[model samples]
Target: MLAGKRILLIIAAGIAAYKSLDLIRRLRERGVSVTPVLTRAAEEFVTPLSVSALAGEEAHRDLFDLTKEAEMGHIQLSRVADLVVVAPATADLMAKMAGGQADDLASTLLMATDTPVLIAPAMNVRMWEHPATQRNLATLQGDGVAVVGPNSGDMACGEHGPGRMAEPLEIVAAIEARLASGPLAGRRIVVTSGPTHEPIDPVRYIANRSSGAQGTAIARALVALGAEVVFVTGPAEVPPPEGVTLVKVQTARQMHDAVMAALPADAGVFAAAVADWRVAKEATSKMKKTAGGLPVLEFAENPDILKAVAGLEDSRPALVIGFAAETDDVIRHATEKRARKGCDWILANDVSAGTGIMGGTENAIVLISDAGAEEWPRMTKTEVASRLARRIAEALEAG
Candidate 1:
């Protein structure tokens, strides 16, 4: 799909700038035409000559270059490409992109571009984790910028964490996904995953046994089918899939807000195992055990996110899907829940003792809809996700 496509590759200042060279070669090998751009600090690591040599084109550096500007203006340069990719997107560069700064050639092109943008962040572990950087990352993702990775590993600053840029092939795969023309192309999906935690104290909280494997697999399958997915997850044991707009939350209320904010989607998959109730009045400090005998804890019902979204009159998704984990009468309970929640479909499964399906790798699903319940054979979570994604695509297309 990348054949004869054009990419504007922006290299920012970072030790990972070196990887951008190999990335250029990989794209070229796939018959992609690359237009390389370098920030001033980027020259400190890889020279313009080397970047130009590999890209088979002149590396654009200065925004005020008279000759280059006379030939091709920055505005034109930004819109000419199929997609703009920023590799080794440093903290500073990401901040500029988020804040709409255009002092440099790279940021100018980024701000001036209307095409989709993908970024591969690489920075120090501390810098990557800093609140400001995380805010910028969230802003960029909210603005529809796709992210490949800043995979966790040892950093050049001798710190070990999530600050490493993804490998060349990984970025290529993300680019291909961004440019793919699959059945669900141009569709936007919202998927909620993991178990929401209701805080009892700063350290202690109430949660469930949800690994988020199934939801993560579902998001991956949707992305592979070329859908733009907004993945809202809690603290899951599994890492989130790439090529998604990821929103992290702690409580059911937070997840509800996040899902509401990402509204008007083509469909919504409420796969999260949300807590039904939370402590009415959480303790500010840790509860003492010896001094005050067992304290009475009051409970309050959490917001019904699935039901709320399904009942939305204005922004309700065309197709709303929910999950039911039951210990008895799976189909009947799921069907009733589907009707009560006003969702289009409900994927029900038994999580009874010894079933090992809740946190396990396999699942047996009974899909409940207006027609009837359809039982599916036991399969891997990935297979289930793929099947569900395809079904969603068909449903959307039919509608």
Candidate 2:
């Protein structure tokens, strides 16, 4: 899967530069081409000669090397690669990236490159814990920058909690995941994510605790498998992945309309936890606090998106998947939901508080269909999405 793929490796200022050398060697062993770039501070730790010798390519260090610029300018250098990896992504470089600063070659290449980026951060535990660092991390993640890890263990410094760079093998796995393509190529799919907002007032709305992690991961996985994904999302905590058609919506009705408009797809994965009801009559103006007693509000059923799409005789997706978040009788409820909604499958999960499935990073899902209910053990939302995407690909290939 890694053969002939080009990786632009950016070595930032950190004590973990040694790890990056091993990273380059590992990439080369997997038949991947590595182009190394070293920041000025990176040179303090690892020599350019060593980096170039390991990579078997000249290490690019300056943003404005007049000779290289004349040959292949910075813009060309940035665009020529399939992916860019930032190793030993120190706090300062991360902050700079979050702020879109292009003061150095590494930062400028990151800003200039359209290729996907994966960062491996390494720093002091205290620096990693800083709110500023956390905010920076969030910003980068939201902008679709992939991160490997700062695995927890003893750091270069005396104190340790987190902030060690991930092992070379782990990083290689992440790279392989990013570059891998599958049978889903040339297929188009639609995925809905996040909890739909039901407006009670202009400023206030009723929403569930869905953080949209699973749906977003599903979309990312689909994209990785060479699928053209239409991602329809409501207010989601995580940002949509790069290289997809993103449609943002606010309410369940809006989400439904968006999904329907992106129709004639290979599949439709309705993972959104849409609200069942909305205010019967939304006030044209914000209702003010009055001396009168409490106002009586009415409720109206929101549009049933899953049923509408699945029941369509002419334009239904070949594979329709709905999500059932049940607290009790999970399989029974999901089975009923699949039948009622006319969807091909229903992925059921327990959203009961203790499960921590809802709005959390991990998911324990049950895949229910006409065949039977297959129980899947607890796994990360990303793993679940990847497995689901692969299943969809297999089903489509068979069909």
Model 1 C-alpha RMSD vs. true structure (Å) is: 4.8
Task: Report the number of the highest-lDDT candidate.
Answer: 1
| Candidate 2 residue 144 C-alpha distance from true site, Å | 26
Mark the regions of model 1 whose C-alpha exceeds 4 Å error after superposition.
Answer: 1-5, 10-33, 38-57, 71-76, 86-114, 119-173
Q: In model 2, which range of ten residues has the least summed lDDT?
A: 173-182
Model 2 segments beyond 4 Å from truth? 1-181
210, model 1: CA deviation in Å?
Answer: 1.3
In the order shown, the candidates' Cα RMSDs to the true structure are: 4.8, 11.7
Tens digits of per-residue lDDT for model 2, 1-399: 788999999998888999999999999998988999999999999999999999999999998899878875778778888889899899999999999999988899889888888888899989987989987976886576766667667877888666888778867866765565668865778899998999888887888778889999998888788776778888899986665656678899989977876676789999998999999988877888888978789999999999999999877889999999999999999998899999999999999879988888899999999799999999999999999999999999999
Please state the error at residue 241 of candidate 1 in Å. 2.5
TM-score of 1: 0.75
